[model samples]
Target: MGSRLNPYLSFRGEARQAMEFYREVFGGTLTISTFGDFGNPDPALADQVMHSQLETARGFTLMGSDTPPGMDLVVGNNITVSLSGDDADDLRGWWDRLSESGVVSVPLEKQMWGDEFGQCVDRFGIGWLVNISQPQS
Candidate 1:
């Protein structure tokens, strides 16, 4: 699939609830995964949302997750712009440029989810998330 951009919201401990609410308002299928599903054994995090997505009939794509432990969740900084798809080359190039002269919070690399993902704050302080989906075998 080609690339797409959307907003990614971060919640302290309410991602599941919030995403469900958005799904209600926007009318979409919502998929959610908890930390436990990813093998996180910590009881405190096991039930917390690791990720959630709401895709509306109008083509709106909303993603979100509960902030992991140890990450500060300041209200003003809880949202990130997500660029995601299966286009690796284009996504990697954009990741390079977007991270140049900026802070690379998470290096662009293969992640536990079997995809290449990264997070960074642009030079102007806007946050970004790039996820390059790996082709299924």
Candidate 2:
């Protein structure tokens, strides 16, 4: 598949509710996973959504996740531009450019989910999330 650009929203505890609302309005398949599904960082957030994906038949893809404690979360800056696909070279090229002169909050590296991922805030203060997915078997 080709690279995708989408918005990834950050919620303090409303990801599940928000994603569900979108699903209701857009009519699509919604998949959600709780923090516990990926080894809950805080017991209190075990039931909080770690990730939620809504893909509509119209080709709209929305992703969101509840922020765990200790993460910097500014209300107005809760949205991130997500770039993801299986093309590592292409993804890395974009990552290099977006992160240059920008603060990389999360260094690009192999994540626990078997993918290379990173998060950064661009020089313009726009947040970016890049994930180089693993090849499907």
Candidate 3:
């Protein structure tokens, strides 16, 4: 699929609820995954949303997740720009440029969920998330 950009919201233990609310307002299909589904053993985080997505018929895509334990959720900085798709070369190029002279919170690499994902804050202080979807075998 071609690359797409969208907003990713972060919540302090309220991602499921917040995403659901957005789905209601936007009238779309919502998919959610909890930490437990990913084999997180922490009882406190098991039920928390690891990720949630809302895709509306109007072409709007919203993604969100609960702030993992130990991460401070600053209200104003809870939103991030997400660049995602199956285009590896394009995504990698963008990731490199976006991370240059900036803070890389998560290196661009294969992730537990099978995608090459990373998070960073650009030199302008804007947060970003890049996810390169792996091909199905």
Candidate 4:
């Protein structure tokens, strides 16, 4: 098997829910572990998702986990995951869902570069940039 790239997201306490939802959206096999499983056994965080991975049938892989103790959970400035492709409709659907309760820095619309682009900070405080190029005629 060849090496692959996947996005690893960090959440304060919503890692489980978020990863589950991604599983639903992408239809994948999901594996999750908790802090307790790793031997921390911190009663407070034992139930929180420590790590989760969703391997989708569509060949997409997404991983996420709750922020570890003392790890800073900040949003919208340092990191922005980007999605770029020519799938306009599919990418726009993602933009709609990602921006539902978040702030949009750039609305998803055709840009001067001839691609539909948008930037938003998701409700979870994760930043995202989506670029959808027009399909060739």
Best candidate per lDDT, number?
4
lDDT of 2: 0.82
Candidate 4, 1-137: lDDT as tens digits: 99998789888899998888667545789999999898886799998888899997767888899987798987437778788888777778878888888899899988997888999987777788999987777
Worst 10 residues of 3 by lDDT: 17-26
Clashing pairs in 4: none
Q: Per-residue lDDT of 1-137 in model 1, one digit per residue for the tens? A: 89998777778888887777656545789999999999998999999999999998768798889989899877656567778899798778778877887799899999999999999886545577999999999
Q: Which of the predicted structures, 3 or 4, would earn the higher TM-score when compared with the native?
A: 4
lDDT of 2 by residue, 1-137 (tens): 99997778877888887777657645689999998899866789889998889998868798889888899777656567778888798678778877887799999999999999999986545677999999877
Q: What is the TM-score of each candidate against the true structure?
A: 0.56, 0.55, 0.56, 0.85
How badly does each model clash, as a count of residue pairs? Answer: 0, 0, 0, 0
Q: Which prediction has the highest TM-score against the true structure?
A: 4
Ordering by lDDT: 4, 1, 3, 2
Look at candidate 2 and tell me the lDDT of residue 15. Answer: 83
- Residue 102 lDDT in model 1? 72
Q: What is the C-alpha lDDT of each candidate?
A: 0.83, 0.82, 0.82, 0.84
Candidate 2 deviant stretches above 4 angstroms:
77-137
**For residues 14-132, what per-residue lDDT tens digits would candidate 3 score against the true structure?**
78866775565447899999999999999999999998989987687988899897998776565677788998986788788778877999999999999999998865455779999
Poorest 10 consecutive residues by lDDT, candidate 2:
18-27
